[model samples]
Target: MDALTALHNRVSTGKLTEPAPTEQQRKNIFLAALRAADHACLRPWRFLLVEGEGRERLGGIFLKAAEQAEGAALTEAQRQRTKAMPLRAPLIIVAITRLQEHPKVPHLEQHMSTAGAVQAMLTAAYAEGIGAYWRTGPLAGNPLVAEGLGLANNERIAGFIYCGTPDKAPRQAPDLAVDEFFSYWGAH
Candidate 1:
């Protein structure tokens, strides 16, 4: 698909199935991510690719983290759901931001750069006929999850990007009005 078409039509695919993106598709996705704009060229982002047994292990880590956070209060259904979260897709990319003290760029901008990278990846996935979803919940911010994922103190989870085959055809992108979100501001 054309770049403009991909950018305008990309949408999150929540119902992903087996058969993850092909190696070439992944390359395109990652390359798009690497092109995200960054201040001072900090390159403050890193990613973890989880698939097959790694997804199971990630689910275990999530379960442990959730259990620690909620204790016995967690219902059986919740526990099972937590354990199966990672199984929703065939492959998962854990986006992380490495914080640094830059004279000009703050931590928030660094995180924004990572967000841009993930967005680019999502668009690229859409262009390649792959399903992709970016998700972040309580588990994403839990300290236990950070430790389990071997994230350092300066590294923070940005999102869990799930990629796979869509269960059905992708829905059309909503036609939003540019005027609704854009405006002219010269000397307001």
Candidate 2:
């Protein structure tokens, strides 16, 4: 698909199947992410590609986070479910952001840039006919999870990009009007 088409049609795929991008394809996806607009060239984004046994490791992080939060109240079944989340897709890309002290870029802008990286990755995956989804919850941002992932105190997981072949066709996008969310400033 062309860039414009991909931009308009890229929607989250919740039912991602197995067989995600190969190692080489993942490299290409990361390359696309690096090309996202970086204000002041802060380049504040980092990525952790979880696949194979790495996915299990990520799941363990989630389970550990749950355990730390709930302690004895955390059920064994819930812990198992946390570990199984990674298996839902063939791979998951953990998006991380590095805080900058003297950055000319604002924190919100840097966050948007990281989101733009996610967009780039999703677009690239769409171009390759791959299904992808961005997901996050309490576990993603938990300190225990961060520790399990070996991230610094200043780093955070923006979201997890689950990738695989389409388990089903994507839904058609709803018709949208620019006027609904757009505003003219100086002159229309």
Candidate 3:
């Protein structure tokens, strides 16, 4: 698919199955992310690819974090759900933002750069016929999760991108009116 087409039509695929993206597809996706706009060239981002057994390990970490946060209040179903979260997709990419004290660029801009990279990867994945979903919840911000993922004190989780083969056809992108979101800012 063309770049513009992918950018306009990309949609998150929540139901993913086995057969993760091929090596070529992953190369394309990562390359797209590398081209994201960066302020002051402060490349403050890193990614961890987890698949197969690694997903199971991530699920364990998630379960631990959830259990810690909820204590005895969490039911068995909730615990099971937390442990199975990583099994939703065949491959997972954990996006991390490494904040630094830059004279010009602040931490927020660094995060924005990471967000741009993730969006680019999503579009590239769509073009490559790979299912992708960006997910983040309370667990993403949990200190236990951060520590389990071996994140540095200056690094934070941006999101977890699940990628694999779509269990079904991707849903159509919503038709949003540009006029409703954009307007010319000129002398009126």
Candidate 4:
């Protein structure tokens, strides 16, 4: 698929199955992420790829973080669900942003760069016919999660991007009117 087609029609797929992206597909995806626009070329982003037994370890970390945050014990079902979260997709890319002190660039800009990287990865996946979804919730902000991921004090989780084969063909992209979200500024 062409770049424009991927950008215009990319949609998140929640139901991903086995048969994770091939090595070539992953190369395309990661290279696209590296091309994300950045100011001052801080390159504030990093990614953690988890799969197979690694995903199980990540799930364990998630379960620990959730339990710690909840204080009260989680029901068995909830515990199981939390532990299985990472298994939803065959691969999980944990996006992280490492904030750096810059005279002209602020921390927010660094985070934006990471977000752009993630968006590029999503688009690249779409172009490759690979299913992908970016997810973040309370778990993202949990301290235990940060520590478990071995993130430094200055590094923060941007999102967990799950990539795999779609269970079914991708659905149609919604046709949203541009006027609804765009407007003329200082009209001629």
Clashing pairs in 4: none
Give candidate 1 misplaced runs (Cα > 4 Å): none
Q: Give a tens-digit lDDT track for model 1, residues 33-149.
A: 999999999999999999999999998999999998987578999989999999999999999999999999999999999999999999999999999999999988999999999
User: How much lDDT does each candidate structure score?
Assistant: 0.95, 0.85, 0.94, 0.96
RMSD per prediction, one decimal?
1.1, 1.6, 0.9, 0.8
Cα-based lDDT at residue 23, candidate 3: 97
TM-score of 1: 0.98
> Can you write out model 3's per-residue Cα lDDT over 62-91, one digit (the tens) per residue?
999998898857898998999999999999
Candidate 4 global lDDT: 0.96
Q: Give each model a TM-score.
A: 0.98, 0.92, 0.98, 0.98
lDDT of 1: 0.95
lDDT score, candidate 1, position 18: 89
Over 4 Å off in model 4, which ranges? none
Compose the digit string of candidate 4's lDDT tens values, residues 14-81: 99999999999999999999998889999999999999999999999999999988884899999999
- Model 2, range 127-181, lDDT digits (tens) per residue? 7778899998888789988888899977888999999998998887788998999
